[model samples]
Target: MKVSFLVSLFMLSSVQATLWGQDLITLDSLRLQLAKAPLAEKSSLYEQLAWEYRKSQPDSTIFYSDQSINLITREGLDRNIAKALNFKGVGFHYKGDNVKAFELFTSARDEALEHSDSLQYAHSVNNLGRIHLNQGDFFKAYGHYYKALAAFKKVGDIEGVAYAYKSLSELYQSQNNLSKALEMSQKTLKIRSKVGDIDGQISILVELATIYELMENYNRAFDYYLQAKMKAESIDDAIGIARINLGISQLYSVQGMNEEALSYADRALNTAATSGNENLTNQVRLQLAKALLSNGELTKAKNYLSKVVAKTAITRELPIEMDAYYYLSEISKQLGDLRDSYENFIMYTRLKEALVNAEAARRIERYEGRLEIEKKERENELLRANEAKNQALIERQRFQNIALIAVIVVIGVLLVSAWYIGSKRKQVNLKLQVKNRQIAAQAEEINSQNEQINVQNQSLQKRNRQLADLNNEKDTLMSIVAHDLKSPFNRVSAIAELFNITNLTEEQRTYVGLLRQICENGVGLIQDLLDVNAFEDQSRKLHKVKINLMDLFTNEVRAFYTEAQAKGLDVQIDVSELLYIHTDSSYLKRILDNLLSNAIKFSTAGKKVVLSAVEEEESILIRIKDEGPGFSDLDKTQLFKKFTTLSAQPTGGESSNGLGLAIVKKLIDIMGGEIILMSEQGKGSEFILRFPITNVAPVSAGSQ
Candidate 1:
C-alpha cells in the first residue's frame, strides 16, 4: 500500500506539471471563450479543475487566488476581492492549514466591512466561526455565529440568516442543547421556505431528522428522512441522497432490523462512491461496519471497521479514526476476543485523549489569533479616522489661505483708491479740502475698528482651536473607558461562571466572590462615567412635570431595594404623597439614582439608609441619610467639583472614582433645583435636594 501511494503521488505530480504548461490562459480569455457556455462551465472548466489540481499541488491554489485578489484589488472591485479571499480561505481549510484559513477569512471580513457588504461579511464570519467550531472553542464560535447572524439580519439576507441559524443549531446540538437546537432548526426551515431555498430546506430537514433520532423517536425520524430523500431525489442531489441513506441505515440499526440496515448501508456506500466524495465514502463505510456488528457478523464487522479506521487515518481525521477503534473494541468483546478487545480499547483511549488535548490547544491558539486580529483592526480604524480628520484640517487651512489672500488683495486696492481720492481732494479749494479731511478722518476711524474686529476674531479662533483639542481628548478618553470597563466585567462574570463547573478551595471561592463585588463596583463606575460624558456633551434635555415629593421618594427607595439587599442594608422611606412639585421623571430618577448609588457605595455594610421628602412652605425637599462613616471637611469643600478626587472610603474599603456628585450637580442645575450636603465627622452624610413648586392646582370640590 505504501509503494502504491508513492507511485500515485509521482503520477499525480507529473500530471500537474504537464497541465501547468498550458495554464497561461488569462481570466479575460477564459471569460471570452466561455461567453456562450452554460453556468456549470465556469466551475467545471476553471474552479473545479483548479481545486482538483490543488489536491496534488496546494501551492497552485494559493498562486491563482493571489492572482485573482491582485487583479480585483487593483480595479477597486471590493466584491471580487472578497470572493477571492473566500476561495483562498476555503482552499487553505481543505489543505488542513487552519491558521492560513483564519487569516484569509479575517482579511475577507475586513474587506466586506469596508464595502458595507453585510452578506459577504456574514459569509466571512461563518467561515471563521467554522474554524473555531472545528477546533472546539464553543464560546468563541458562538460569538462569531451571533455576529454573523446580526450582520445577515442587517442586510435582510434570508439565505445567509438561514445558514447562520442552521450552523448555530448544529453547534448547540453538539453541546446537548436539544431545545435550543430544535428551535433554531425550526427557524431555519421557516426562512428557507420563505425564500424558496430548496437546498437549505433539505439541509434543515436532515437536521430535524437527526434531532428526532436523538430523542429516540424512530418513526418520526424515519418519516423526516423519507421526506428529505424525496426532496433530494427531486433535485437530483447525489450528496443529499447519500446522506439520507446513511441516516436510514442508522435508524434501521437502532430498531434492530439488521438485514434492512445492512442493505441501506450498502446503498449509502454505492451512492457515496458514485458521488466520488471521500468524506462521504468514509462515513458510509463506518455505518456499514456498525450494521454488520449488530447482525452478529463479527468477522465482517472487524474487516469493515479496520478499513474505516485506515481510511480515516490516511485522511488525517484522527478523531473519527479513534471512534472506529472504540467500535472495533466493543465488537471484539462481544465476539469473546478479550485480548484484541483490550488492545483496541487501549489504542482508542490514547488516541481520544490526544485528540482532545490537541483540540483544546487549537482552540486557545485560535482565540488568541482572533483577539490579535481584532486589536489590529481597531488600531487601523483609529488610524484611518485620524488621517481623515487631519486631511480635513489641511483642506480647511488651504481654503483659509485662499480667503486670506483675497482679503489682502481687496484691502490693498481699497487703500490705493483712498489715496487717489485724498490726493484729488488736496488739489481742490480750502473749504472742500476741510470737508475731505473730515471724511478721511472718518475712514481712518473705520480702519481702526476693522483692525480691532480682526484681532477679536483671531482671539476667538484661538479659543475655538483649544475647545476642539479638548473635545478630541474627551472622545479618546471615552473610547478607552468604554472599552476597558466592559471586558474586565466580562472576565469577572466568566470567572464566576467557572464556579458552577468546577470545585474550588474555600480561599479560591472567597476570591471569586470578591472579584464579583469588584466587578459590580466597576459597573457602577462605568455608569457614572457614561453619565459624566453625557452631561459634558451639553445636549441633554431635562423633562419637567409636577410630582408629589413623597411618591417620588417612595419610587426611588423601591428601586434601590435589591441593591440594599446585596449589602445587607435597610432602606426606609418617609414622605407625604399629597405634596407636589414640577420635575421630569427622568431627571428626578437620575438625581435619586446617583445619590442612592453613592450612599450605598460609601456606607458601611449592614447599615440603615433613610430617605425623606417634605414640603417647606413653597419649596419641596428630599433628603437621603445613611448610618455610615461621614465625609471629612476636605471632601465637603470640593465635593461637587468636576474631577475632584475624594479621600473618603467605604467601610468595606471600597474606593470611589468621584464623578457621582458632579453628575448630581449637573442634573440639579438642569432641573432648576439645588442640593445641599450636611455631614458630621463621625455620622453619615445627608444630601438634601430641593425643587421649586409648580402651578398645577388639585381637583376642587366646587367643580365636582
Candidate 2:
C-alpha cells in the first residue's frame, strides 16, 4: 500500500509540474502531459496553456492549437477542433485583433453546429458576441447572444444560458434600456441560482447593483452590492472581490465621501494586483485616482492618475486612456493649468468620438451588405429566366422548319435543328456558368468590401455616441451657466435702477430694500455657480480638512439665525457633537448652506425645523426636516432640475430664484455625494444626505 501511494504521488507531482511550469516546454512535452491527463482535463489544460502562451507568443499558441485541431479533425475528432478553435480565437482576441478572432470563432461555431456540439456552439457564439460587444457592435452582439441562448437551451446548458442573459443584460444596460436590462439580469440571476452557480450569481448581482445605481436608486444599489460582495468572498474569487470593491468605491465617491472611496479603492487595487488581472488592475487604479481627486488629495490624485495614464498607453487601453485624460483635464484645471486642461479635454473628447463613430460605421455597412445580397439574387433570377426563354424559342423554330420540308429534308432539317438547339443550349449553359462565376467573384469582392465598410460604420457609430454624450454634458453645463447669468443680470439691472432714482418715497424705499434683498440672493447664486464651474473645470484646487459635523451645523445654523428669528421659527439640532467627517471645506459649506437656506425659505412661521445626523455602517447620514408646506407633487419630481421650479413664495414673501437646489445638486455631484428629499402635501418635508468618513482622522477646521 505504501509503495502504491508513493507511485501515485510521483505521478501527481509530475502532472502538477507540467501544468504549472513557467515555460511552454515543447510540443512533445504537451503531448506527454496530455497523455498523462484524464480525458476530461486534457482540453481544459490545453486551453489554459494556450491562453498563457498567447500573452507573450501567440504564434506558438496557435501552432500548438493548430496541431491539436488537425489531430482532432480526424474521424470522431471534430469536437476536439471546436475546443481548439475556441482557444485559438481567444488567443487572437487577447492579442487585440478581434476581427480575426471573430472569424475563427464563427468557424468554430459552424463546425460545432455541424457536429451538433451544442455546448461548444454556445461557447463559440458567446465568445464571438463578446468580441462584438467589446467593439461596441451591440446589435450584432445581441443577435449572437440570442443565438447562443437558443443553442444552450437546446442542450439544457443552464450555465451557458445564464451567461448569455448576463451579456444581453449588459448590452441593453449600455443602451440605457433599463427595463430590459433589469428583466434580463433578473432572468440571469434566476437561472444562475437554479444552476447553483455562486460565481455567476455574484456577477449578476453586480450588474443588478449597477442598474439600480443608474436608476438613482441607491438603496437598492447598496443592497445588491453588499450581496455581491458577500458572494464573491464566499467563493474566494479575487476578481469578483476586486470588482465589488471597485463598485463600492464608486458608490462612495459618487456620494463625495472620498475617504471611504479611497479605502475601497485601495482594497480593489490590492486584490486586482494579487490576482494578476491586468484589466481589473487598470480599472482599479483609475478609480483610486478619481477617488483621491474627489477627496481633495490633489498630489496623490495626480501621481496615481499620471501612473494610470502611463499604464493606459503601455497597455493600449483606449477606454481607460480616455478616462485618464479626462481626469487629467479635471486635475489640470484645478491646478489652474488651463492649457494642459484644454489639451487633455480635447484629446479625451476626440477619442470618445472616434470610438462612437466606429460603432455607427459598422451598423451602416451591415445594412448595405444586406441590400447588395438581395440585388444579386434578383439579377441571377432574371438571367436564368432569359436563358430559358431563348431555349424555348430555338426549339419552336426547329419544329416549324422540319414540318415545312420534304420527308428526308424535313428529317435532315429536324436533325440539324436538333443539333443547333443542342449547341445553342451548350453555349447558353457555358454563358450561364461564366456569368455565375463572375457573380461569385463579385460576391466575394463585395463581401470583402462589406467588411471594410463595416469597420468604417463602427467608427462612425462610436463617433455618434461620443457626440451624443458630449451634447448631454454640454447641455448640463449650459443650464447651470444660464441660470447663474440670469440671476446676476437681474440683480445688476435692479441695482442700477435703484441707484438712478433720486427722489425715493417711503414706498420706494421699501421697494429698494426688496431689490437689495434680491441682489444679495443673486450674489449668492453667482458664488455657487462660480464654485461648481471652477471645480468642474478643475480651476479651483481642493483643500482637504477634517470636520466635526456638529460644529459645522452650528455655524450654518448661526449664519441663518437672523432669518429664522425674524420668521419666529425655532431650529432644532439632533446631531452628535463628537461625530466627525472629512471633506473639502468649501464644497461642504456650499452644500449645507444651500440645503439649509432652502429649508428656511420654505418653513412656516413659528415652525420647528430639525437638523440631525447619524452614523450607519460606514456612512454618515444627515437629515434636515422642516415643518412647512412640503414640495408640491410637480416640484418634488423636478426640484433639482434647472429652470423648472415650483416658484414657491418664501415665508416672508421673498422671491426665490430656483437656483439653490440646482446648485446644490451640482455641488453634491462634484463632491461625489447624494442628496434626496422626502416631502408630503402639507405636513412637512425632509432632505436626507449621506457622506462617507474616510481613512483620514478628523481634525477641527474652520467653517467656510
Candidate 3:
C-alpha cells in the first residue's frame, strides 16, 4: 500500500526562506575562515556563516548578518551591506517576525537601489512579493513580482530571474491559475537546470507536479512527482524526500486510493519528522488526517487533525488550518456531536474565506483575462504583419513571372508574325464552329425534354380526373348507405314507442326504454356519418352570409332544451355582446347542433350547459360548455379523429359512437372557423369555436 516519494523539497524550502541569503557553506568552516581572515574578507565569511544557520538557528543568523553589515558599512561596501540586511530579514522572516522582516527588507531595497545593485533590489522586491502573498494581498504580490522579474531580467541575473518566476508560480497557483503557474514553474526549472541548481530544479519539479494535479492530469502529475523524487534522492535532500512523499500521498488521496494514501501519508509524516522541519511534519500530519478521514476512521482522523489545528494556531498556515477544521467538522458530525460539528464548520468557512477572499480571486481572474486578451491581440498583429510580408513576396514573384513570360512572347512573336495571324484566324473559326454545334445540340435536347414533359403532364391530368370521379362515387355511396340506415333506425324508434304505450310489465317497460335508447343512438350515428362525409369533401361549397351570433346561440340552445330539461339541466346563453359572422349559416348551425347535443348527452342531472358568443376585432367566438366528466389527456389527442373511444362516458347512460366531436370539427373547418376543446377529468368540458371576422362578418351589424 505504500509508495516512496523523494519529491524535491528544494523549491519548497526556498519559498519558506522568503528572503534567501548567500550560498550554503558549512558553518564551522565559515566561522574558522572568519577567525583567520582579514577584516575585508571577514564580512563575506560572516555572511556565508549566516546563510548556513538561517534555517536552523535564526537568532544566530541575525547576529552574523549584523556583523557582516557593520563591517561592510564601515568599509563603504553599500552593496554588501544591502545584501547583509536582506539576509538579516530572512532570519527574522523565518522566526515569524514579518513586521520586522518587512522593515529590514525595505531598508535593504533602498540601500541596493542607492548602490544601483539590481540583483539585490530584485531579491528585496521578490521577498516582498512573498510577504504580500502570505498576507493575502494578491494585488501587491502581483505588482512586486512583476517589478522583481523586470529588474532581474534587466540585470541578466539568471538565478534571480528563477526566484521571481518561482514567486509568480506560487501566486498564480493560489489564484487557481494552473496553466500560468505551470508555465512559470517550467521556466524556473529550465533556468535552474541549465545552471545546475539541483535544489531549484527539484523544487520546480514538485511545483510542476502540483500544477498538473490541480488540472486533474493525474498521470502527468505522477510522472513529475516521480522525477522530482529521483532527483531529490540523488542529492540526498531529506526535506525534499519528505515533501515528495507528502505530495504523492495527496495525489493518491485525490484518486480515492485510501489504503495507499494512508500508507504514504504515514511514511511522509515519519520522514518529515526525521527531516526536522516542523512545517513539513505538520503538513504531512494534515494529509494523514485526510487519508484517515476518507477511510472512515473518524476517531483517529480527528486526533491527527486536532494536532494540525493546534499547530496552525501558532504557525498560522491558514490553508492547512482551514482544511483541518473542515475534517474536524466532518468527524464531529460522524460522531453525532452536531454542536461541535457546526462550530468547527463555522471556523473552517471563516478561515477559508479569509485566506482566499472571493473579491481578490475575482480580481485576479479579471486581470489574467485582460492580460490574455492583450496577448492574443499582439499575436494577431504579428500574424497580420507576417501576412503582409508574405503578400509582398508573392506579388514580387508574380510580377517576375509575368515579365519573364512577356519578354519570351515578344521575342517569339517577331519570328512568326504572319503564322501567328493565320493561327489566330483558325482558332477563332474553330471556336465559333464548336459553339454553334453546342447551341444546336442544346436546342435539340430542350425540344426532346419538352415533349417528354408534355406526355407526363397529360398522363398526370388523366389520373387526377379519375381520382376526382372515384371520390365523388365514394361520397355518393356513403350518403346512400347512411340514408338507408337512418330509415331502419327510425322504424325501430317507432316500434319502441308503440311498445311503451302497451300494457306491459315493469321489466317489459324497461326493455322498451332500452330499445328506444338504442334506436336513438343508431339514428344519431347515421346522421353523424352523413355530416362527416359531406364535411370531409374538399369540393363542398359554403354559402357565405352575415348572421347575428346571439340569434344563432339562442336557436341552438332552444333545440337542445328538451334533452337538457329531461336531465334537469339548464341551458344558458351568454348574450353579453351580439356579434355578426359572415360564414355559411347551415355549416355554422350544424357545428353548433352537434356540439350542443354532445354537451347535453353526457351531462348529469341538475347540471348546466352554457352557450356563449363574444366578438373581437378579428374573430367571433362561440363556446358550448357542459358540467360532466371531462376528457382525459389521451382522449383529447384523438377527440376529433374518427371513432375515438374516450375515457369519459355519458353520465346519463347515453350511447356515444365517438363521431360527434369529429363532425363538429369537420363542419367548422368547412366554414373557415377553428375549434378547441378545454377539459379536465372530474371537472367539465368546453368546446370553443372561433370564426375569423374577415370570414364571420362581411359587414358590421350595428350593436343593439
TM-score of each: 0.46, 0.42, 0.42
> Which one is best on TM-score?
1
Clashing pairs in 1: 543-584, 545-583
**Per-residue lDDT of model 2, residues 86-137, tens digit only:** 8898777656566667668878887887788889999999888877665555
lDDT of 3 by residue, 615-639 (tens): 7767877888988899888887888
Which parts of model 2 are misplaced by more than 4 Å? Answer: 1-64, 75-144, 270-282, 309-322, 325-329, 335-704
In model 1, where do residues sit more than 4 Å from their true spots?
Answer: 1-64, 73-80, 93-156, 170-176, 194-196, 215-220, 252-260, 273-279, 309-317, 371-704
**How much is 659 displaced in model 1, in angstroms?**
90
Whole-model Cα lDDT of every candidate shown, in order: 0.76, 0.76, 0.81
Rank order by lDDT, top first?
3, 1, 2
The lowest-lDDT stretch of 10 consecutive residues in candidate 1 is: 1-10
Residue 530 accuracy (lDDT) in model 3: 84
lDDT by residue (1-704, candidate 1, tens digit) is 32233223333333323322232344456656556666433332344334444554566666667766665656666565675687778778656577678788988888888877778789899988877765555787799999999998988888888889988886777677778988899899899889878776787887788788888888988988898888889977776788788889989988999898999899888878776566667777888888888787888888888988888778866656887899999998998999999999998999989976875665576567556655665776898799999999999999999999999999999999999989877777677878899999999999999999999999999999999999889877986877788798978778787884688888988888888778877887787787777766667666566566666777787888887887888888887656666667887788888888778877776788888877776777788898767878988899898778876676555657778789889888877888999898778889998776453335344522
Q: After superposition, how far is residue 226 of candidate 3 from its true place, in Å?
A: 1.4
* Candidate 2 weakest ten by summed lDDT: 12-21
Error of 3 at 221 (Å): 2.2
